[model samples]
Target: MIKYALKCEVDHGFEAWFSSSDGFDEQAAKGLVECPMCGSAKVTKAIMAPMVRTSKEEAAPIEMRQAVAEALHKIRKHVEDTHTYVGGAFASEARDMHQGLTPERPIYGEATTEEVKALVEEGVPVAPLPVMADKPAPAVQKKLN
Candidate 1:
């Protein structure tokens, strides 16, 4: 399937889908296509960049990809080196700190989505950490090896 941006003589712009390039031409030539706003049959293809999508590997060559990977690794290393890992007690620890029951300090830990949401809803500042390539998958909260 192909999609095209179309414009009428009156300059009404819209989008429509076609089975193929020939289908658009056939429909336009027969005056089957008309502007929904102005009802003009004099519609033509409007100038538009083709929609293209590529995976990370295709979008960035090896050198560019290596640079990105190195940057992410450095970020992970910084967070690991500077932040205290609190295991599964993250939500309670954060709440205690916010309520002045505990001293505030840099920390990284695990918390479920619900816990994180509740913390945010109650105005506690929190952000998710980036995924590291060494990890199988990201946890609900931050943790480092």
Candidate 2:
């Protein structure tokens, strides 16, 4: 089945599905097709936006993938070199820092969903990292022989 964005002479736009391009022409020729909004038979195909393909490698070049990997690696390394690992004490550590009970430092760790919610509710300014805070760089899997 094929879908086409259609526009009528009255400037109304809608979508219609047909078996094929020929099927649409055959239906339109016999006055079987009409605009849903205006009931006008003077409908024609509108310029449709191109569909995006989502399959991984089909969407980007190898070079682009390599570049992205490099960028992510750099970011992970920077985070590792700079931040203190608070482990499972993330919520408490963040709270202590926020209340000036501890000196301010960049820290990463695990927190339960409820703890994260509490942090946000208290305006503790926490953000979840894209990579797992514990694993970081090695989160990118290496293919084994």
Candidate 3:
């Protein structure tokens, strides 16, 4: 398998794995390759410096992955705590902000794949939030009198 750093037309960076270089080309040509964040199919391979591995131990350690995960969690928490939840109107709100119809503000919400693609096409900056698994609600206890 080969790993590639990919970017969407909107400049969202991501990574994917393919069976081969040819496989990547084929998938991209067929519109099978898409950005994980915004679901934009206008994805392309990003410039990558070739890594020449000297030893198996040169791979990233578990600690590094943990650190990355912790950082992402913190970012999610910060956005949730600070940004306005615009719900399903994320696309329109972002567009309004971009067009100066609304005040620019930190906002987060749900948006469809088409909405994101359109926003990107119109030069509106928008991105998808990483969805974490929902925590179960607290259980209700019954009181016997």
Candidate 4:
């Protein structure tokens, strides 16, 4: 199946599907297609770029994935090196900081789901770490090693 962007003489734009390229020409010649909004039969195909699909390997090249992994690793490293690791005291520490009970400082730590929900409800800003895997990717590990 093929889809084409069509425009009428009155400049009304719409789309229609055809079985094949020849089918579109045949239907258009017989005035089977008409502008949906203006009801004009003088419709023609508008300039369009064809959509192409590449194989999975080509779609996400190794270099692209490696660059993304490297970026995430840098972010995780920065957070770990710069932010205080409060461990299980995440909820209390975050709450204290928000309520001005403690000095404001960047922190990264573990929090229970209940603790997280409560923090959000109380308008304390907190978010989960984005590190997906406990172990770094083989590429990153190799670079470190």
**In lDDT terms, which candidate is top?**
4
Q: Which run of 10 residues does model 1 get worst, by summed lDDT?
A: 136-145
Q: Where does candidate 4 clash, by residue pair?
A: none
For model 3, how does the per-residue alpha-carbon lDDT over 96-118 read when each residue is reduced to its tens digit?
99999989999999777789878
Q: How high is the lDDT of residue 42 in model 1?
A: 81
Per-residue lDDT over 1-145 for candidate 2, one digit per residue giving the tens place of the 0 to 100 score: 5788999776779887678879889999997676654345778999999566666535345466455555666666677779998899999999999989999999988776567667867889887653423432342434110
TM-score of 1: 0.51
lDDT of each: 0.74, 0.72, 0.76, 0.77
Q: What's the best-to-worst order under TM-score?
A: 3, 4, 1, 2
Which whole-number lDDT from 0 to 100 does residue 33 have in model 2?
76
In model 3, which regions exceed 4 Å deviation? 1-13, 16-37, 41-58, 134-145
Q: Per-residue CA lDDT of candidate 1, range 1-145, in tens?
A: 6889999876879998778989999988997786655445788999999988756434335466456556666677787889999989988998999989999998888776567758877888776664455742233123223
- Provide the global lDDT of candidate 2 against the true structure: 0.72
- TM-score of decoy 3: 0.59
Better candidate number, 1 or 4, judged by lDDT:
4
Q: Point out the higher-scoring one by lDDT: 2 or 4.
A: 4
